[model samples]
Target chain A: MDRNGLEKQCLEVRRLIVKSVYEAGSGHPGGSLSGVELLTTLFENFLKFDPKNPKSDSRDYFILSKGHCAPLLYSIMAFKGYFPVEELKTLRKLGSRLQGHPDALKLPGIEVSTGSLGQGFGVAAGIALSLKIDKKVNKVYALLGDGELQEGTVWETAMAASHFKLDNFCAVIDSNKFQIDGSVETVMGVEPIKQKFESFGWECVQINGHDLKQVDEAYQAFLSHKSGKPFLIVADTLKGKGVSFMENTEKFHGKAPSPEEFEKAMIELGEKAL
Target chain B: MKKYLALREIYGQKLVELGKNDENIFVMDADLSGSTRTVLFKNQFPDRHFNMGIAECNMLLFAAGAAISGKTVFASSFAMFETGRAWEIIRNTIAHDNLNVKIVSTHAGISVGEDGYSHQANEDIALMRAIPNMQVLCPADALETGAMIEYAAETKGPMYIRLSRETFPVLFQEESYSFTPNQAKVLKDGKDVTLIACGRMVDFALEASHKLEDEKISVRVLNASSIKPMDSEAIIESARKTKLIITCEEHSIIGGLGSAVIELLSDSYPVKVIRMGLKDVFGQSGKPQELFKFYELSTEDIIKTVKENLQ
Candidate 1:
């Protein structure tokens, strides 16, 4: 896929996310928009997933460690044919399989159940190690929020991964610079994320998360370099990338779009998105 | 009933045996290998053993993830650290998802000794049993513990087995003993009353039954170790036969074995239940026997409670 095509797909995903979250009435929009391009490229082109046989032994595993961005993941998975697009509207409702958090047990295409921050990487690392034990070559990909770096377990597992030299494991840090509370700088100060990961013995790559070619090239670049260490791609992203009103805005961190504001947000993410 | 074996030892042996038989079985620990007895498994099957340093949450989450992808995983750690510190990971990754993870925690109950309140896991059973689709087991002796460990490993979905640091006597005959998961064991027969207990308290219940027998009070003794399922059949039948119940354990009265028995029998059979356990108080550093006695989990306490309930 070319740069413009990837960019257009990312924008279309953002539009779908906005529309779904708006219809659902109670879904995360801020972090979802922030990670638009990163998720788009990974699920669209990078990941080796067969949606029809989601738990195929040969298929690559994708775990959203930053699971609060369920709306974004659900939108992408629905587009990828894991479930019906209509099920997106029932998110957060009592009987909806689309729970407030990502439940892998109830939903297909979700490799692990996640929502609690920092814990996802530990689970992802295990999956990677298990694949190694099985002598399987399927790569393990985990996408995490930068603010989630505040968790101590992330570093513990990071050090363990480095110590194990799990080159098959790949992690993407969506550096949206904002948490549920405020700016990442103010809330937990996980800056120099690339340096931190590198210090833990990971071969690090820093790139603009909005740039699809850069993201794909970086992922491919990391994959090619079998340096006996895991890869951590620190993608610099806006908190709310696509929508003008929500970009880098701390207020939308967890707030669901109101009924009145939903149309305008949808209009911005309409058929002709950025 | 003097010479006893710690359940952790039994779990460690069982893990090594299972690991040797199945290459897919991976054992993950959180640096407390000495206490949890996972070191035995590690030494036996070095290739499949993973030590995650002092990170309990990582150990648990990693185990669940490994289980999801074809590894029959057993995660071992000290109960206090695993249940007290890494609760969220166990809640979300293992139990909430209902993953095929057998979580075995040693140093359970006040019998963990000198470790004091911070190290002893007095509430792990309650913490794990509350989760949906989760099985809770606390075996009384090494024989029962061994059987429970095998049952947990073979069973599907998530399971939490609370093992002990304090070794109680191996009371049952291994040749004749069999543990049915989620089923209560009816050890002794009586018509006047039923004495239900689990883990360390099983010995006390048996002793109390003997003491009461001398007093001409025929009290039935039950090893209701499966805390979550609570052995409704045994509880119901015993309740019908005896019309009174006396439950004991080495945990809190609020959510441990005593509470479980009451919860099971509240609707139909509202019999009088005398609970003998730590009276909603934290434990302090002391000898295992001293602590057990102080918490009223001793044979004397059980006997007294049984007599009081009979009246």
Candidate 2:
């Protein structure tokens, strides 16, 4: 796909995420918008495995460790044909496979059930280690919410991954700044994110998350580096990336967009017939 | 009934074997290696073993990451310490998502003896059994404990198998005894009444049954090592055949074997069930045998309970 087409798809995902929440009446939109392009790049390029064969042992695994931001992950997986894109509307509804948190038991694309923060890195590290041991070169990707660094277990897992020298693993922290309650700066400063990673012996990279070229380059660069350290990419992102009203706002962290806001978002995304 | 095995010895040996064959099997200790008997694994496979200088939470989370990477990690610590200190990490990191981790905690029940209430973890089963996707095992002896080590290592998801510091007789042979996770073993079956128990309590239950048999009261003794799966089929059948039933364990009556038996029985066939346990009181510092007698967890207590039920 061309760069413009990929960017368009990412914007479309951001709009659909707003719409899904507007329809569901409850969902996380803040981090979802921030992660749209990354998820798009992952589904379209970096991650292996045909969506037709979700359970193939050789497939590269992706875990949205900040799992509450299911809107982005669900959108990407549905678009990638892991499930019916229409089912994305049923997210957080009773009996919907799209639970408030990603359930590996319920969803084919989800590798492990994760909602509580800071622990997915541990699980992803394990999966990466397993792949490496089996001689399968499929990389394991896990995305974390920067606010989740308040959880000590994440750092604990980070140390173990670095100690074991898991180069097959790559973790992306969505530095959207705001958490459920407030901004990470006020809540718990996890700044100097790169230094912390370096202290833990991880290969650290910082980039503008909204820039698709940077996101793509980071992926390619991570692959090329044979450092015996786990790769951590700290992406600086707005809490809500595209829509003006939602940008950097904690109100949209877990709230559904109103019907009026959804219309404006869809229009901004250039959706046709809707 | 006549014999039981101390699980710590077998836990050590089985870990060494697991570490030898599977380089992916990692063992983490929290400076309790000598007490928990995980020293054998550490001695045999130094590379795969880690002692994290008394940091239980780090040990648990690190193990979670290691287990995720395709390593079967056996995390060893004192029963009360690890289960209490690092429970949330264990629940969220390993068990909640169903990571393959073997949580082997020694000094369970009053058997840790002179260490007092702080060291002995009577509530270990209770805490572990509450979590979803976690299987709780309390092996009757060392042979079964060794067998359980391999079983838990092979099984997917989180498993907690309680062990004891004190050594007892080797109940079953290392070569032939079969132990399956969540499957209760019927050691001595009788028609008069049923006595269900786990861990060190199984030994007392057997001894009580022997004494009762001398009085011509045939008591069925079952080793309910698997606490979570509860073996409802065996429990119901036993309840139906034996009109009176008694449950014995080293933990509190609130959430241990006694409570589990009552829950199963009340849900299905209501029967006369008497619970014999620590009765929700904290233990004291003393010799293990003295604590057993003082706390009424001894075989004599079971024998006395059986006689009272008969009357």
Candidate 3:
């Protein structure tokens, strides 16, 4: 799809995130909304996953290292026909496969269970290593939050991925600046993120995350990376990309939109809540 | 009985055998391959081994990823770091997903000796057992450790096998000895009292049983190697037959074999139980035997406890 068509689909996902969080009365809408385009583009364009057979051998794998953004992952998977789109409304509800965090056992496309920060990245690297060892050509992708980078395990995984020369692995940091408490820099600075990954021997790329074309180019560079190194894309993103009130706001990081606020969010995204 | 054999040595040797036979078997260690004895597999199958370089947390997650991707994975580190430091990662990724990953940790319990309290993993059993769907195994000696490595690879889902650093007398040197998950091996048969033990402490329990026989107090000994899915039927039968039970291990008395025995009996059939091991305290720098004596895990301690708690 072109950039314009991708943007429309991104808005649809953003609307789904808002509606699910609103119905569940709890979720990280801010971070979930920020990662819409990143996840949207990957699932729609780059990811080679089978909706019929989620665990097929000839398919690629993706892990959500910043697992609190389950709303976005579930929305994308549901929209892609992995499951019924109506299941998105059951987010965080009791006895639902759409858990608060991605559960690999409960859901098919989820390759790793990653509620704890920095863990999924290592798992992603492990899958990449396995694919390399098996001589398979499947690419492994992982999404990490800017605040989640504060975890030491993330750096450990970064160093290991590059040391192993996992060219099949690509990690993108949803650098949305804000965490639950405040700005990621004020809380715990992880600036010079690209240089950090570069020093770790990864091919680093920086792009405006909200721009679909830039996101596509970043993945393109990732695909072309064959300098005997892993790939890292540091995409600068807004905390809330689509909805006006929630953007760049920390209060919406983990709060569910009220019924009235949900109506406004749906209206802004050109959708109606059921 | 043959001279004592280091559990880690047998573990390392069995890993090589397992690796040679199954190409799907992969080994990982956190720069402690030499100490954990995963170096044997690393030497044999260099490409199949991953030296994770002192990163236990990431090593576990990596193992989970590989195991889920259809590889039989064995990850090793000291019990303290592998089970204590990276417990949540193990719980979330391996246990929650029910992935086929075997976390066989070495240097468990105060048997870590001169490394002192910091290196000892006194609470590893408790930490592993608390996780839902995790199978906890503690091999009694070198023979059982070898058998367990084979069984662990064959058995599916998340499993933890705890091994000690110090070499102890071989208990399962008999030709008929076989290791089975959740099954207690009755090493001695008597009726006055039943002695239940796991890990290296099983040898001490056998010693205690013989010494008690001289005093005309017959004792039955059960090697409770499978800690998590405990041999509850055997425990319940022993509770009924002997009417008194004594549990021993190298771990803390609070949550090791003793706790498992008491927990089972309290639910099914209650009996008078005496728990023996480290008494809720950290160990100091000492030789393995000296620490065992200091912590009252020696055979003399078991004999003493048996005498005191006997009917």
lDDT values for all models = 0.85, 0.84, 0.91
Comparing 1 and 2 by TM-score, which wins?
1
> How do these models rank on TM-score, best leading?
3, 1, 2
Note the DockQ of each predicted structure: 0.80, 0.33, 0.83
**TM-score of every prediction relative to native:** 0.97, 0.90, 0.99
Residue pairs clashing, model 2:
A126-B68, A126-B69, A127-B68, A130-B69, B5-B141, B5-B142
lDDT of 1 by residue, A69-159 (tens): 9988998898889999889878888888898889987898888888999878988898888888777899999999999999999998899
Ten contiguous residues minimizing lDDT sum, candidate 2 chain A? A265-274
Could you give the candidate ranking by DockQ, starting with the highest?
Answer: 3, 1, 2
Error of 3 at A250 (Å): 0.9
RMSD over all Cα atoms, model 3: 1.1
- Per-model chain A TM: 0.96, 0.97, 0.98
The weakest ten consecutive residues by lDDT in model 3 chain B span: B171-180
Model 3: how many Å of interface RMSD? 0.8
Candidate 1 per-residue lDDT over residues B1-311, each given as its tens digit: 27878778888888887877778888889888887888998898887889988888888878877988878888888888888798888887888777888888988889888979998888887788777887888888998888887887787888888888887788899788888877888999999989898888888889888888999999899998888876898898999999989888888888878888888889768888888888889999999999977887889887777777667
Flag regions of model 1 displaced more than 4 Å: A270-274
True contacts kept of each: 0.79, 0.43, 0.76
Compare the candidates by DockQ and give the number of the best one: 3
